[model samples]
Target chain A: MLKITNLHANIEDKEILKGINLEINPGEVHAIMGPNGSGKSTLSSVIAGKEEYEMTEGEIIFEGGDLTELDPEERSHKGIFLSFQYPVEIPGVSVTNFMKASLNAHRKANGQEDMPANEMLKMIREKSELLEMDRKFLSRSLNQGFSGGEKKRNEIFQMAMLNPKLAILDETDSGLDIDALKIVANGVNKLKSKDNAVLVITHYQRLLDYIVPDFVHVMLDGKIVKSGTKELAYELEERGYDWIKQEQL
Target chain B: MELKDKLISSFLAFEEAFDVDSDIHEVRSNAIKEFESLGFPSKKEEDWKYTSLNTVLKHDYSVFPKKEDALEYRDIKKYLIHDIDTYKLVFIDGIYSSHLSETTHDKIDVCLMSSALSKSKYKPIIDAYFNKIVPKNGLNSLNTAFSKEGAFIHIHKNKLADKPIQIVNFSTGNESALMVQPRNLIVVDENSQAQIIERHQSLTDHPVFTNSVTEIFAGKRAIVDYYKIQNDRASASLIDNTFVEQQEESVCSMHTFSFGGKLTRNNLNFYQRGERCDSTMKGITIIEDKQHVDHNTLVHHIFPNCESHQDYKGIFDENSTGVFNGKVLVEKEAQKINAFQSNNNILLDDKATINSKPQLEIFADDVKCSHGCTIGQLDEESLFYLRARGIPLKEARALLMYAFANNVLESVRIPELKKRITSQIALKLGVSLGFDL
Candidate 1:
């Protein structure tokens, strides 16, 4: 469903992603495990078309089209979703309204009319209920004064509402508690279909236990060094990332 | 001839047309003398440093419109809060339009300023509160010298106004260049309540200059809410001077919304005379193109235990410019005063400019006064976040700007008025935000 060829990204004078390439097929779950400053987040951001990062020498093909020339919104309309590590707080926009706008934007891009008011409300109620979100949570300003758990849950909630073709979870497990982790994982698992894919980027294997990945890739420096099955995640969790560097050397 | 000299010469004709034998002649003569001495405020003055009036002043504005042009309600209904029942004091080319007005004297006085200033029955109220708190500023003096007609509202003691009052002045553009000075007087008796909405609109593209003055007197325990809507065409310029007086336990608040205009200058001042008075001044200015808006405010706490709040926000796009000068003064005897002033601005493009200055002078040893000012661009990460959610770039920006300016509407006591302001903001941002609650 997604392809990255010779992805070389840079921010300003420094090169972040030296040379990286990865592919994820539909109906499969892929996990990229890396340490701090290993370009894990940069890869996710570049795939999502962040303007600050310069794609020095790379072409991202999503759904058989080049995403390098597409804007973030255009990529979004083409079914790409990025769950941010730190969500921005918009003081006056309610989460429910935000969801409605997002959903309608995608519809508009496809030359479709906005979802009916009652249908939109029903979808919001169903999605928020699935994520164990309080109805009151949908009325408050978007991410304003929300707890860490609530912010992460809200991100997952947006992912569910948009239902994009490719879901990139960047550090989604950073601020989630055990209960929130379970709920988030359950939500992601339910939304996963044969036509869509999920890419989980994290440093810990704790989340992999919930939403087990089909393939595990160990990323170091700026490239993928090793590829293994789900068992590789458990082994790395036990031995730590230093073992990967030793094995590479 | 120069606009200033033209206005001075026109004062004689204005006096000859109006009641020269009336009691307000002395006041008018003195005000014209002040305008003659001060001329028009220049950029050399500290108060007018960031704003220049040279372009708007060069127009040979007809000091008095030659004819009173009639307008159909349907043509101008869009400019008013027409959804609700309001006491409308409508003016066409600075002349009172009786057919378009709904003035009343039942329990509360929602009428015209000409009647209040000329009728003997209202002489007592006029003699007591007419221009009592107005200061001697150049534009203010010009407004006073030519003060003729506007809305005059009076709520009886312990009475509540039946409905909101709307004062709208429409320039017909019948003349080549028209100038109007609308004088408004609002006096709420002790323990009364009132809400007033004022707007200045130009019907055509002809250049219209309006110098307006409003004086609001809030008696003891009275509550007064005032709204000024400055949404005019690029061919229109406005100068508004509003003075408010609050007594013991009274509350007076004014909110100015400037969405479109060539140039607009608001000189708003408040004086707290008794203890525990609450004064609020808030504004939101969103102007694109070469439009300009200036907000100059002052809150003087003369009595002890008084409180004042000021929150002004602006969004300047394209080549628009904005200025905010807010001052809070606490007298020596005014102990335990709480005065807070905050000014925040966002410049969308590089050419857009905003000059914000928050001044606080505290003479009392025991007072809490804080002022803050910020000018910057929208958050890039926030923009990216919204864009990533499938919202287009323009819609994302408009949403953010709407969110930034929505909090000021929270204090609007009327639901219909709040909704009107909300939609007006969306219109200004060029987006139908659909902020339905």
Candidate 2:
């Protein structure tokens, strides 16, 4: 579903992602684990087309299209999703309204008319229930004064609503309690199907236990040096990333 | 002749039509003299530093309309809050349109100032409250000199108004360049409550300048909510002077919504006369093109245990300019006063400008006064967050701006008025979100 070839990226003059390559097939969950400053988040942002990160050299082909030239919203219209690590606090727009605007924009970009209001409400109710979100929570301002758990759940709720072809869960496990982790993982699992793909990026292996991945990749110094299966995540969790660094040296 | 000299010459003809022997005649003569002495405030003055009236004042304005112009009720129907019942005092070219007005005298007096000033029955009310609170300034005196027709509202002691009062002034643009001065007087007796909405609109594209003055007295424990909606044509300009006095435990709140015009300057002042008085001032200004709006407000705490709040937000696009000067004063005798002020502005275009200054003069040791001001672009992180969620950049920017200005709009008590302002804000932002307000 997605392919990256020697992705060379940088923020300003400093190099961040150097010579990285990865591939994920349909319906397969891929996990990318790395230590701090190992370019795990940078890779996800590059895929999502964050403008601040300049790609010096690379090609990202997603679903038979080159995503290198498209902007973030264009990429989103082409079925790319990035769950942000820090959700923005929009003080006046309620979550339901935000979702509606996002959904309509996507539809417009695809040359489709606006979805019916009743259908939109029904989908919101279904997805919000899937994430165990309170009905009242959808009426409050978007992510304004929301707890850590609520923000993470809201991200998954949006992912469920959009149903993107390729979803990049960037640090979705951070700042969430155990119960929230299970709920988010369960929502992701329910949305998984043969037509979509999931790429989980995390620094810890606790999330891997809930949403087990088909493949595990260890990134060090902006390159994925190790690729294995579910057992690899357990091993790394027990031995730590220092062993991988020493082995690479 | 210059516009100032023509106004001086026109004062005589303006006086011959009114009751010259009444008690307000001396007040008018004194005010005309004051206006002659002060002329017009120049840019040299600290308060007028950012907003210059040179361009608007150069027009050879007919001080009064040639004749009372007739307007079809359907043509101007959109300007009124038609969904709800209201006490309307409508004017066309400075003349009260009896056919368009809905005045009452059963429980409260929602009538015209010309009646209150000339009629013997209302003379007592006019004597006790007319021209009592307005400052002796050039523009205010200009309005007082020509204060013949406007809305006059009076609520007796402990009498709550059954409906909101709407004071709307429409200039039909019959003359090439016309100027009108309207004077409004509102008195809420002790323990009474009232809500008022005022608007000034120019129907055509001809040059129209409105110099309006309003005086309000909130008696002990009374409550008053006053709203001013200034959305006029590009050739129109307005200078609004409103003064409010609050007695013991009274509450007075004013909301000014400025959307369109060539130039608009609001000088709103509040004086707390007794203890436990509450004063609130809020405004939202959204203007584009070469439009300009200036809000200068003052709140004076004279007695102990008073509180005041001021929140003003502005969004300027294209070459528009805005100014907010908020002043709060706590006198020596006014102990335990709590005053808060906030002014936030966003410049959508690089050429747009805003001048915000918060002035606090405190002579009391036991007072809590704080002020905050922010002038910047919409946050980049928030923009990216929205855009990444599939919202286009333009829509994202508009949504963020609407959110930024929503706090001030939330205080508008009337839902229909709030919806009107909300839709106006949305139109200004140039985006139609698929959600109700």
Q: State the lDDT at A217 in candidate 2.
A: 98
Model 2, A1-249: lDDT tens per residue?
Answer: 799999999999899998988999999999999998999999988998888899999899998899999988999999999998898898778999999999999999999989999999999999999999999999999998999989999999999999999899999999999999999999999999988999999989999999889999999999999999989999999999989989988
The top-ranked prediction according to lDDT is: 2
TM per candidate, chain B? 0.98, 0.99
lDDT of 1 by residue, A170-207 (tens): 99999889999999999999999999999999999999
* Each prediction's whole-model lDDT (CA): 0.91, 0.93
Chain A only TM-scores, each candidate in turn: 0.98, 0.99
Off by over 4 Å in 1: B432-437
With a 3 Å backbone cut-off (N, CA, C), the pairs that clash in candidate 1 are: none
What lDDT score is found at residue A230 in candidate 2?
A: 88
RMSD to truth, every model: 1.5, 1.4
Tens-digit per-residue lDDT, B1-437, candidate 1: 99999999989988888788888887899999999998899999999999899999989888877788889899889999999999999999999999988989999999888888889999999899987899887888888888888989999999999899999999998988898999999999999999999999999999999989999999999999999899899999999989999999999999999998999999999999999999999999999999999999999999999999999999999999999999998999999999999999999999999999888888999999999999989888999999999998988998889778878888888788888888788777777443353
CAPRI quality of model 1: medium
